[model samples]
Target: MRVSVVICTCGRASILPDTLDTLTVQTQPAHEVIIVATQPSDIPDLTRYTAKMPLRVEFAEKGLPKQRNHALNILSDQCDIVFFIDDDYMPSADALEQLSRAFAALRYAAGMNGTLLADGIHSRGIDASDARSMLRNRPAVGPVPIAIKRNLVGLYGCNMAYRTDAISDTRFDEALPLYGWQEDVDFASRVNGEMVQVNTVSGVHCGTKLGRESSGEMLGYSQVANPIYLSGKGHIPPVFLLKLTMKNILANHLKQLCPEDWIDRAGRARGNRAALKDWIRGRVSPDRLTHVRPSPSGPKP
Candidate 1:
């Protein structure tokens, strides 16, 4: 039952210590803590925690998925599961324990699981702003767990777990330009297993802290390109996919209204441009995309 915790971070040094503190208190302390960091100077004083517990920190000189792939690839053979945590998130004390329990239950049941992200939180001004996360805010009355034996629309990588065996050849696709979409879901579906949605446990996702460019935030352009790629792969139904693409375009346009800065405005414009171009091309020049390569083995986690 050894689990390897991978945290992919780039330059968010201040908040990382807090996340590490939370990790130390997990009911099931991870066998190894691997930091796939990009910014070299941001590495913390390891002696503080390492003297008391097992911890290993490493760096990657690439984007999110590439770093994740590198980190996942280097995990020792003894690791039975891989737990992914984004840099900006802090898990509850029982997060790792809950994930281990969920995976154990999945193995016993001969199935897989889909993770539920804490899309909203009362602390730190976190709240769900879109329909995609409308269901994450209910009171945690009890440990409500449910079985969903279907293809997940997507996997929330911020707080997701994967079995070593199930993900034998799985890795996040580094080729995808934006980290915003499709890749995780693509990999999960190709893994060919049952995925359940677990609501019994949750974590705290501190949204967009310190204005860092997490894959989740950047590549907003993926909001448009992703649907096209998915549709080309025939993984997503056309009508629904069309609706989602349109919605993302509208959302990006709306976001353009409240540009945090010039860079944000530029990003929004790029996203909106991608959306409009794809949509218009879908109608007037459907065959114009004959040269774009289809996704290979689909999206990577």
Candidate 2:
């Protein structure tokens, strides 16, 4: 099958080199490479990398839907399948081939989830050499040496593949959430498909410390708010949303163990206040109550 690998990157040129190298060496090389460089100049050095590579390069304008949606809209017709891998990830040589094989083997499955290998370190930069070291032993999460499958809640956006036809029919929702959050979950929820976790391709998901957003950015807020929005639409329940938000907050705090940066005491307090306020004012969005009823056709796709 002709597969196009889609990578959406924003201002991370340094990491692309390793990502490109891995792609170039894929056992099942992608038919084409379409990069949605969110920033026009984010990859000025693209020519240098594409010079000796067989893959063709393409760019997309950056926006809220992010590069994945941009690439899908433009390239879906050109490729049979579209595989997305993060700029920071290094794919196994056979990752592409395996993902395709999994889909072929499981005709009913719409999407397959690939495993992630986080280094657990926050600050150090990742490179090709580091990827090789991590790959030598094929860590537990490193490579899906065998093919196993199961129904899944969703696929991790960074390392997943989908038939082009699936996405061509309905592009990812741009208005769902932003700042690297929930696009995958929300997309899977809306798309009519059976999700699967597949034991196919696996590779080191490199870690980074310095360049990522610090605490000041309301990443936590978006994580919380997006679920709230989804719940209001009846995609999820309020209690479940609260549980997830609190769990996410606690997990981050546990990882950092820094109260000032991790403890969201005020957020907890404000959450209660907001709930109380909504209850008192009867100002819940219509979606939270009346709109949740199934459509005439039944449950939404």
Candidate 3:
């Protein structure tokens, strides 16, 4: 099956090099590499990426959903399978091949997310050498068919693939804008075919800390607002959304009590409170988060 890898980047030039470097080593090279940047300036320098694979760069407005949607539209009638991966991730040598094979075998599955091999998504000091070493001792991933249950949400926008023909009318909902928290769940929910999580299709999410990170306020607000919005639309169960909402709220509050360097507890807590307040006032949605202006030196949009 012909496979195309889609990446939507928001100017993470620092980590993008490592990401592209790792892709060159894939056992089965991608048929095409489509990059959607928020603006022309956001596109990374391709001079370093000398591979012969066809590379396509396009521009989109400033939002994850919009950027991803733009790329999908461009490749509407192309490729058998489209795999989406984050800019800060490094795929194993066999990751693309494994995904292709899984799609060939799981004929009934419409979309799928890959198993995340262990690696620091935010680890500092990682270079091309470090990424090469990490792929050395990959754990054996067994063949497992994806099954559907009400709570079984499978397709993650990051590290997920879908048969080009199977995702008929489904598009990433632009309503869930910006960093697009829970955008994956919202889009996957609308898909008519079964979504699965596969073991063979796996990669390392090199969560690099040197790039633009989501502000606590943005994340916190989305945590409260996105789920509630999705639930109201029947994409998520209220109880499940409640679990997700409360869990983050409690975690932020707990961390506030026992401050951690790694977590922005107070900021996220503020976002959660803001969302709840907005919800009560009859204004709750992903757009609310977009309207919020970031503090100077805060998370970039």
Q: Return the top candidate by lDDT.
A: 3
Per-residue error for 34 in candidate 1, Å, reads: 0.8
lDDT of 1 by residue, 1-301 (tens): 7778888877677667766876778778888888988767767676677865578777776567777887878984758878787766666667677777777765632223334454432223353233124223534534534454444555667776777787777666555542425566655555546655675446667564453442222344566666676677665457766897677666656756764332343454454464456667664122222223322321111
| TM-score sort, best first | 3, 2, 1
- 65-149 in candidate 2: lDDT tens per residue? 5567777767748877788777777887777887777777777777777665544233344656877676656645333233355
Task: Say which prediction, candidate 1 or candidate 3, comes out ahead on lDDT.
Answer: 3
Evaluate all candidate structures by whole-model CA lDDT and list the values in order: 0.60, 0.61, 0.75
Candidate 3 ranges with C-alpha deviation above 4 Å: 48-50, 119-129, 141-151, 291-301
TM-scores for all candidates: the values are 0.74, 0.76, 0.89
Q: Once superposed on the true structure, which residue ranges of model 2 sit more than 4 Å away at CA?
A: 51-64, 119-128, 139-149, 215-217, 236-242, 252-301
Report model 3's TM-score to 2 decimal places: 0.89
Segments of candidate 1 deviating more than 4 angstroms? 108-151, 178-180, 214-218, 234-241, 255-270, 278-301
Q: Taking the tens digit of each residue's C-alpha lDDT, what string does model 3 give over 1-301?
A: 8899999888686667777776777789888888888776666678767555678888889788898888888888789988889887778888888888888888887788877665553334345566667677777766653332223564666687889898766788899877788888777778777888777766777655554545777778888998888888886667877888899889888878875555566778878888999999998887888665444554321
